[model samples]
Target: MMIKSLLRISTVKVLILLAGLMLMFAIACGGDDDSAGDSAAAPAAEKKAEPTVVPKKSVHEEAEKKDDSAASGAAATATVAAAKKDEPTATAAPVASSKYGGTLNWGTAPNNNHVFFQQYTPGAGAAWAMNIGDPLMAYGKGSEWLEAKSMAESFEVSPDGQTITFKLKKGVKLHDGTDYNAPLHKWNLDWVLNPDNAAVTRPQISAIDKVTAIDDYTLEVHTDRVYTPLLNALGMMGGMPFSREEYESKGEDHLKTYGSSSNGPFMIEEWIQGEKTVFAANPNYHQKDTYPYLDEIVWVEIADEQVRGAALETGQVDVADINSKSTDVIAALRNADDIFEAKGMAGVRLSHHNAARAPFDDIRVRQAAQMAIDRHAWNDILQGGEGHVYMGSVLPPTSAFAYKVDEYMYEYDPEAAKALLEEYAAEKGLTLPLTHMDAFKCTDEQLEIGCTDLEKREITVTVGKGAANAARAEFEAAAFNAVGFEVTMDIAAGKEGPRTFVTKESSFSLRGFGVRPHPAGSMDSYMGYGGYWNNGSYGTSDAQMELHETLKLAGQAFDYQEQVRLYKKCQQIYLEHALGGVKLANAPSYKFWTTDLRYDGYPDFTEVFFPSDTSLKMYGMYLER
Candidate 1:
């Protein structure tokens, strides 16, 4: 990814000098350090970067014009150069003026009533909540900073780091025409913290001791201890506040019976369950200047990816979420000139293992299981060589806290896997059931791949199948051998299924952790005793405990260098213990948007694309006249 930032010439000069000296030493000693050489030579290697020129025709047509390997290499080189330059070499088309009025037609998968408060998951529901409800804090689009000037004007952390004070944006009105004040904030917090609600956001704010309304617009949130990801967590689903009046008057089932009552830029005008949800601009929104350029936003449920793509192509829908499975759609959209744009961000796909169970409890068995499957082949088969192999770490290399340790990556070794499985079978004969949820189209294929390899190793593997929820339930009940699922740091950190697994209510399961903007948010959720995904009783080994401690220290450590060092240590510990389950492959989440949708502040299309947080805030989004 090309980061837009001014180049520091002085820093580059120093880097060049260091590189030159290293090259001299390497040549003098006749030493071969290809990786080291590449890193050192990167900065000084090029004075200017060449931009990747997307062909005017289809990708397939473009591929036919040039040598496939050569073109790919050039693109890779150009990408690295652009990243080093911290700027886009190609000139982007000028963004047109944002015009308000038209209804933005959006398509999404079925929500199954999870779009309501307290029950909403982080998938599609969180994305909807981001636009419908206001958060106390927000993350900057494609930026590392946490934006505090949203729902809350300012915030203060106590010197002890246990208390946080927030001043609400004055004059903000909820969808129900009630004033948004400190009491409302406290009310939302109380509801989430209430065990009766069983809110998924509970674990995210579990460290908070209490929330109190200091004044009409002032709120105080005190934590039991120093919670590191508190601010980031607040920027997520946990921070969204609902209308108190609607909840109280309409009753507990109001959200389900009626609709969303939020104080964001938009309010639910009408919701035809399973069909569509229509939202109109909130007239009394706090951020009046950016209240909403679109007069109405209609979110239609389109389960089929191909159908969603077709809708977007035919101008029936303005935006849709497309995955790797929608390869033809993605290619078609990418080929379309100014009509459509497809953007993808790398996320992890994993096969979760049950560390608490007998065969998986044995480290060798786990290693064999991981080694049996060829991740490269999986990527080729599933993603068409578009995915990157994810090592054990949840954080991508772009993150500051990411570790450079690759020794933990289990290489595809069928011989070693067969030997290990044979040894295990000789010791104790067992039939392992490989399970997968039917929701993910690739799950069956992924399981089959693993099962086929295991069968070759003389290991009996049975296929267990069911609906997504049913599979999850069966896995939680420990009725199967290994269950396959998709996971993210936020989901794992929540109080739902991942938390139950962490609590040792369920045994072994396979899952993936996608790449997150920040490492701590995801890492903390799966690391220590407090982690939502740490079955502390069953999976907490001595090494895992040490890793947890290291992560905790990293969270508290203010020094950037110290934090990196601690995170590195934690990664080492994780790899040593093989606590990250079995990592498979990471692929970019492909999302498409119509070119007609113009965003006010976001001049670049890439700025508004975030698949992880689903933070494509529609407040400032407008249609181009």
Candidate 2:
């Protein structure tokens, strides 16, 4: 899949120096109860960042497309490039923009069995999401938000602000045609949160306590409390509505039952375990005439990103999401006459701290680690100019919520790093060899391609005991090296880290991209909504307690600007406390579409066609020669 941003992804082969991050990091902004509270003190700094409620309704296609176009900023690029008509490359219609859609066969990691809707498959999720679900609101080319129409045409906030009413678009139907009951062709109002339905994602809606339908086109949701972003929250991946009748009856085969029906632009037809998944246009699909211009989209989840790139370069696939870490692949496909590539930065940055025993607990150790990173050197030598430099924090500079701070953040100065380490050691009786740590990562194509590329630049590459014992080994190595103590790392998927080893403070190991809820950009998740962002998931502090209470009432705080202002101030408070974790970099969200297809609605980033987010706006997306 052509993902949204070109994440500095290292195919397990490249050593990611303990992939960790900051406010700019793309943690899950996903709405999980676990992310309900703030943990530790935030680094003394700043930043802030949207909402909604609808019982249920079909999504509007045009608004989605329009918003996508705005996100890509493609139109601006297109208009300018149009002026250079003399150049064939600039004048010719974009190959990717050409219209076509069919069953796309794709592949993904074999064990992606996690059922939580919040936990979406990265590469696989991108291709499947547009077809399977609808986010509350989306931005298109030019970063335009399309909310005037669709499933949630318009909504109203309640008097006490505890309830939100949504005016839906009538005539919405479930793909399976399973309405609430017989003789009553109404949509079942119970499936959204009733875990009794046993739907895999029922837990996500657990917060909604109750649901009421005012009329066919109007839905009302009564929350336990007045959550400001409720409606918009429903538009997210987790908020996707599921049909209770469908799940209740077809519970026997969950995937077959759910996968068989989608009210979106397309319907998935087949899933061949291990090889590929294929998709086809949904005849009854709400946006039928508008969609799937081509007949199908096949995604082959190749573990090896290099192989994926190889496939693209060799024409086996029209396009592929190349790893930013795989410089060779980038170089390979860029030079290939048959292929052309575009590069964008992911918000994800890399940072690790000394959060163990004495020094890291001292903050300066983390400062030293932050300072040791030669920003220019890392990008220049390892990145090969493919990515850019960023400071600690998950709130990217581009986001509207990030509060601009006056501090320099931590910078790369081996001398500064040494000084901080020395100062802390001298003052607190800390020792040398500050335990450097990172999470254990799995070995896949990304690693091979990245390692192969890095090898060209004279960097040492080694596949340390591949995923299994990598975490333990990494921690042991780092801890041991920290003086005579054995320092090493423990590698594991983001999920496993917390359940088993999260609070082992002295023996802490770092992991990347799990601290946030869904997008990882939400104020609650960052400031500690649930356990995440708090003392490493469950760590508690007074500052965090203050922030959590404020976020709850931010809805009534004057206007949207003032509401957001409060969140910003809260972020600064968290920062001053050093919060639970240090964000290294933000991972860019990349969305890839097949070259044979044309549509509008994508995220903000560079796109084959320009939309502010480079997302193809449904209205703007059309197959053109």
Best by lDDT: 1
Which portions of model 2 miss their true places by more than 4 Å?
1-127, 135-149, 180-209, 224-226, 256-260, 338-340, 350-382, 413-486, 492-521, 531-535, 546-550, 553-558, 570-575, 588-597, 601-625
Q: Give lDDT tens digits, candidate 1, residues 1-625.
A: 1111322222232222222111111000000000110100001111234222111221111111111111111110101111112322233333443466779988876654645755664445555666787778665543233333357766666666677787778887788888888999899988887756767556667678899999999899998876655665676556788887888877767686566577777888878877898888887777656557678889888877778878888888887776564667677776655444534434355445445444555656666666666767766765667665655444433333333432434577656655665565556554333222111122354333221111111112211222332333332232112222122212222234432333332223334453333445556655654455443323444555666667677666544344445555565455544565655565545556665566644445444554233335565567765
* Candidate 1: regions farther than 4 A off: 1-98, 142-149, 406-408, 425-511, 514-517, 533-538, 611-614
Candidate 1 RMSD to the real structure: 14.1
lDDT of 2 by residue, 69-123 (tens): 1121112221211121222233344555355543333322243333223344332
Please state the error at residue 354 of candidate 2 in Å.
Answer: 12
- Per-model TM-score, in order, reads 0.72, 0.65
